[model samples]
Target: MLIQYRRDIADLQQRIRNRRLQTFGLFGTPIALVATVAAGVGSKVVFWLHTEMPNPIVNTFTASAFILIAASVVQFWAEIGGEVWDDSGTSVRDLKLDLALAEERHILEARRHTAPTADRQASYKERLPPEIVRLRMESRHYRRLHLLMQWLLFISSAAISAVTAWYDPPQPAKGVLIGLGFTVTVITAATGYFKPRERAFNLQQTADAIEQHATAIELGIAPYNAPEEARNLELFATTVEGMRADQRMREQQLDQPQQGQQQVI
Candidate 1:
């Protein structure tokens, strides 16, 4: 049963990843079209600003590289965020479960135990392996990094856009062209970063829920229910068992005597 749970969790993670990638792929074309049209319009305006009327070649080609680079960053963000929001739906459920467990634990402790506090404390004493703890820390680090990088891209694009918008760029036509390009960059960045980070939030919520459940169970307050959020419960269980096994092996070795006999003087 535990093995099956492990498999289920692995499968869920894979599904989420695949869905995110698929969404990004599907969105690529539309994003490309928007970028292309914006570039075309900017080019025409630049031409008109330089001459009495629009010159498509000078404006179009010059702005093409900037627009393309901006578009690439836009696409990168969309691809990264794809389908990550699906986990948000379960956030309420997990939070509710934690609250319910805490309430149940309190009532049970008051009715049956003189000191439920000790039990709760003991439950948390079951320390996770050093490696698992490290992994969890690393996961948080990566999440922060992802968010930071996205924001940096957004701010840079906005600054460039503002510069382009403010400068007359030879005449009104060139100014308009640069302004539009920057405007699109701002919009793309806003969409990518401000969008809900449901997946990461859900995972954190689930981890918290699991901890609460474990505590409640130890206090004899309520039954524990492992969340299927990230399917990490089984991994948690497996890690615990492995740690125990290592301890037992170490104990056995300590109890055994040295195999070789020493020579008498």
Candidate 2:
């Protein structure tokens, strides 16, 4: 179970890194290009505007350049807003809890191996609830964070692309504009390839299933309500194991790469 938790944490961290990279690429590159263009040609353009007679071509280029710059600025702002919402600390704390639970599980395993005693087995059982709780909580945290990132990436890409198209930058900045388009395309593709929303939904569903089974067992409800306490405990263990197995299957399916596309991480 701790091994599974570690995998989950690693997956979440990878997704976070991907999202940050997307945000940086989408926002930073365009801003830098715009700044470079402005620095290199700004004074000359301003002088031309003030001194030279305005021609249709010059007027069109000037308007297009300013519009492209404005669009880039807006795109940068949107990306920044998304980054602010991406609070990775929440997931980091969850990972810390998972590590602590893993350590406790290791200690219990060692004790049981050393003693092979009923008391040690009982101690191990006593530690199960907290470990399960930690797993469920971590899953839930990962789900929420991933969901947030998915939407952020989707909306930011869409908005930026639309703004870029509307601006339709002049020929001089065409390369930069093309680069922005490519960046948005990559970000969108990454979001779909990752399927963050699907991961979140699957994880949340698994967490809920685990919680329901655990709760039913604790309450001694049907399937776990037995005259023999030992039998009831056995059923509880079996149910939990089944739940974990199902979750692992779901995760495995998720881990499989999409057809014609390699896994990103």
Candidate 3:
């Protein structure tokens, strides 16, 4: 039964991965973003000159540009209008529920099998508290967003610098330069003010601490070495809750602006 559940979970994971690839395609989003920007520039140039030239200057983008054009068509077609993540007219929700159910079944089976053993380490590992799970999930989410924004900030700043020297005779287009400047400013401000990295770090730290306590409890180590099994579990649970509360307090502190002591220069 455990093996069957494991296989089911793996199959569901593969299905979800395949669905994501079909929905977004590999390297599709970044390619689409670039293609969109290029199309904007090309369309603007064509509109200003009012001339449509036929012939490929370079066929480098031809293979990749199909994804962008197809996206527009897909969006415009009412009969097949599904956004990258809408999951409309699909079994995405059902698949997710099935995956969760399979995972739960596997854990239950494993725990049942290991209950009589002197060391039920695997059971304890699989029984992580909900707060720890949530913390880890949120940590990764914030870290992902934080890194993406930082990269955007860096790229936009670099692009602005490059654009300043791009045009012939070193005279960049005023409007384009202004637009790039705005983009860099927005990215910089967002990353600087929001501080997703700090939030992720705190959450990860709290989760790690909670997991450590849980491990000690499972191993019959100090603090969790109390004679009663229930007492050890209770102590571990209480410690996890305390860490979770501390994590929340840290997040709230991150949201509030820091006040520096007065400095006389």
1-265 per-residue lDDT for model 3 (tens digits): 7788888999988877765665454246556858666875686586645764344532434544666667656643522564544443455567788789889889889888766432344344456778688889999999999999878778877877787778754454767778878887887777767788988899899888987887787789999788877667666666766776877777766766555212210
* Candidate 1 ranges beyond 4 A from true positions: 1-139, 170-196, 224-265
Give the winner by TM-score. Answer: 3
Instruction: Give the alpha carbon lDDT tens digit for every residue of 104-222 in model 1.
Output: 55556556744454444344346543434553464476467557656766665666666666764636456555665666576565545433243344334444544554455445442
Give per-residue lDDT, candidate 3, residue 184.
Answer: 79
lDDT per model, in order?
0.51, 0.63, 0.70
TM-score of each: 0.28, 0.46, 0.48
Of the candidates shown, which would achieve the greatest lDDT relative to the real structure?
A: 3
TM-score-wise, the better of 1 and 2 is 2
**Clashes by residue pair, model 1:** 47-55, 48-53, 48-54, 105-221
Query: Model 2, which residues run further than 4 Å from truth?
Result: 1-125, 165-176, 259-265
